[model samples]
Target: MLAAQRRDLLLARLRQDQRVVAKDVAAELDVSEDTIRRDLRDLAAAGLCQRVYGGALPASPAVADYPTRRGVGVASKQRVAAAAAALIQPGTTVVVDGGTTALAVIQVLPTTLAATVVTHSPTVAAALAQHPAVEVYLLGGRLFKHSVVTCGAAAVEAAQAVNADVFLLGVTGVHPDAGLTTGDADEAAMKRALARRSADTYVLASAEKIGAASRFTVLPITAVAGIVTDAPADDDTVRRLTEADIPIIHA
Candidate 1:
């Protein structure tokens, strides 16, 4: 087949499967792996897909700006939020990450609950203003406008002084093989720093994040305490996570 025909077929496969392995696509197309690689490279350049280690994912899965994401997965995020908020026991210090999902967790937190909540998101800090019993500490750093979170030396340094009972992490993608990933490198570093200071860390993800991969990896799947998602236990991504022995909490 012509190069154009091959590329078109590959895109179709990517749309259907959300991912396409180089070796598998090459075999199906009866083409050399080199040819498939070139097609993938061209597609990535055109912003049609994203190139990963052994395959390609449909565009970038790192997510859009905060407002856009807040509207993307409302129900799933709310479910995940409720489940995450349940993990926070009264009087314990908790580190909350920034994201719509993380904000949702803050929203669902019990009004009567008493705890110390530390976060890098100004939005999260403001949300806790009405919670009389909750102590709020906002980590300071250079503001990242896209996600509306703080990152940089100041944020990482501040995280060092915090020792929390639990860290509620929010990410753009979660995959058993790719691990937990986000859109920005600095944000990933900040998250790693928080995870190190926490007794346990749990990822809050919607179904769209499952099986997806992003630009920067925060932690390996094993490093996290467990995953809380809206995807069913029987979903393919959940099965993959379970097979890896990572705990899955269906929200």
Candidate 2:
């Protein structure tokens, strides 16, 4: 019931759920929403959590490291991955960007599906390596340590050689005005090249990623042909994308 106790409890909940809503915490701790916000702010200042709109999220979710990213958002990524994987037809060359979402797509790839997958993420390459029916092409370049994806001039050049049917882009943020953005400059550059080389580009994002903006811009909304998310297509966000002329597919 004390401030320190409440803060500790809130952090425990955030660790377990990956995020915590202010209203829920307020009710549980018999405090006002403002008080919960103060606690969140204090926690964030202490480097204990990252505050989101209505709540706080764990400072580091999956993707902080390769091993940690493997299981984060497993169900949602699986659904998104399944849908993205289904888009690949026989004999198609596809480019999967470097993100946990794209890695999820690789994990659920059907044994019957056949295609050449181009990616810069070591995690994704490792996943696709187990698939005998798929041809995996690892792009070479300087490795981005946080995401464990290759980027730089070499990787960009390697992406230019292939004309892919689809580029499955993993977005850190998707806003109507900001379009698609990411947190890394090198990754953004690589994604831009992948989009240019592919005939069609699809963005895979979770609901939380919608309306968010990161530090680096990748592609604009018009550049993406479709967006696949875990939420239902009838959600307001899906309708917004539909109105904007971007096709929305529910995972």
Candidate 3:
């Protein structure tokens, strides 16, 4: 196929599947993996896709909006969220990061628990507001249009001031070596600040995020006290994390 036709085909597949693997494209198009990689690089350069370790995802999924993302992995996120929320104790301060998974955690919070929730996510703050016993503190900063989360220096500073019992961090990608990373650099920075200010930090991830890497690094896996994921506890991935001394709570 011609270069233009090949690029169009690749983009169409990405739109349909939300991701594209180089090997799959190369085999389908009868081209070398290098050719597929070059196509992906060009697409990424044009801001049409975000290249990942072995594939590429749509530059920004349509559900990049907080409310939309909240519905994407509703079941998995709820399971993970319930597990994370169970760790919260009454009258303790908690920091929730911005992600659909974290929003799920807020949704399942008990109505009777008394606590303060500091967050950069407007969606999370809105969810927590429904609980009469919880105090929601929404940080101020530049809003990220796609995620609808406040980020930047102001948000980071606000996160640093609150000493919380736990910080439930949402990760874009978590690998054994790459640790934690996010698509947005500012969000990663804010998460790091939240981790540093909290007494304990727990990462919430889905099975797909494991073994993945993103653009910006947040912290090493060892930095977190625990991880809550939808993957099986005894899976090789979870076992590796457990061996590192970080407790794994499989939902």
Candidate 4:
């Protein structure tokens, strides 16, 4: 088959199965493994798939820009946010990540719930301004406008002083193999810094993130205490996570 036809087949398989193994596709198409790998490489370069060892996984749609993400998964974000909001204890401090889902958590939190929140997202910090009892600390740094979060050496340094009870993390994708991932490398580093300062970190994963992969990995699934998601129990990603004994906090 032509390279274009082979790539089309790879995309079809990806949409159907959420992943494509190079060897399996090669054998099925009666082509060399190198040919299949080349097709996969082109697909990855085109932002259609995330290349992994011997295969590729579906890329996430959640990597869209800040304003665009506001509309991507509204209801699912509410569900996951509600569950994540419940994880913050009454008097404990929490480090909240930046994203639409994290902003949803701020909305779901009770007005009178007393707590401390440290965040790098100006949007998240502003949303918490109306909270009667919660103390908000906005980390200062060069703003990464893609996700509307602050990141750089300055934000990383500020995060070092934070010793929080928990960290609510947001990422672009949550695949069993690719682990926790985001679209930007520096944003991924900032997330890791915050996770390190908190006693426990819980990922805010709406249904859309499951089964997807991104360019930069933030952390492995095992690094987190649990993942808070509204994705169905029978979802392929959820099923894979379950089989691996990963603790999932369902919304």
- Per-candidate TM-scores read 0.93, 0.73, 0.76, 0.95
Ranking by TM-score: 4, 1, 3, 2
Q: Which residue pairs in candidate 4 collide? A: none
Best by TM-score: 4
Cα lDDT of all candidates, in order? 0.88, 0.79, 0.80, 0.94
TM-score of 1: 0.93
Give candidate 2's TM-score. Answer: 0.73
Give me candidate 4's TM-score against the actual structure. 0.95
Candidate 1 ranges with C-alpha deviation above 4 Å: 1-8, 11-18, 46-48, 58-62
lDDT of 1 by residue, 152-234 (tens): 99999999999999999998888766788888899999999999999999999888788777778899999989999998897
Candidate 4 lDDT tens digits, 1-251: 88888988889988778899999998998989998888888988888898999989998889989889999989999999999999999999999999999999999899889999999999999999989999999999989989999999999999999999999999999998899999999999999999999999999999989989998999999999999999999888899998998899999
Q: Which pairs of residues clash in candidate 1, taking residues 3 or more apart in a chain or in different chains?
A: none
Which candidate number maximizes lDDT?
Answer: 4
Residue 155 displacement in candidate 1 (angstroms)? 0.9
Alpha carbon lDDT of residue 207, candidate 4? 90
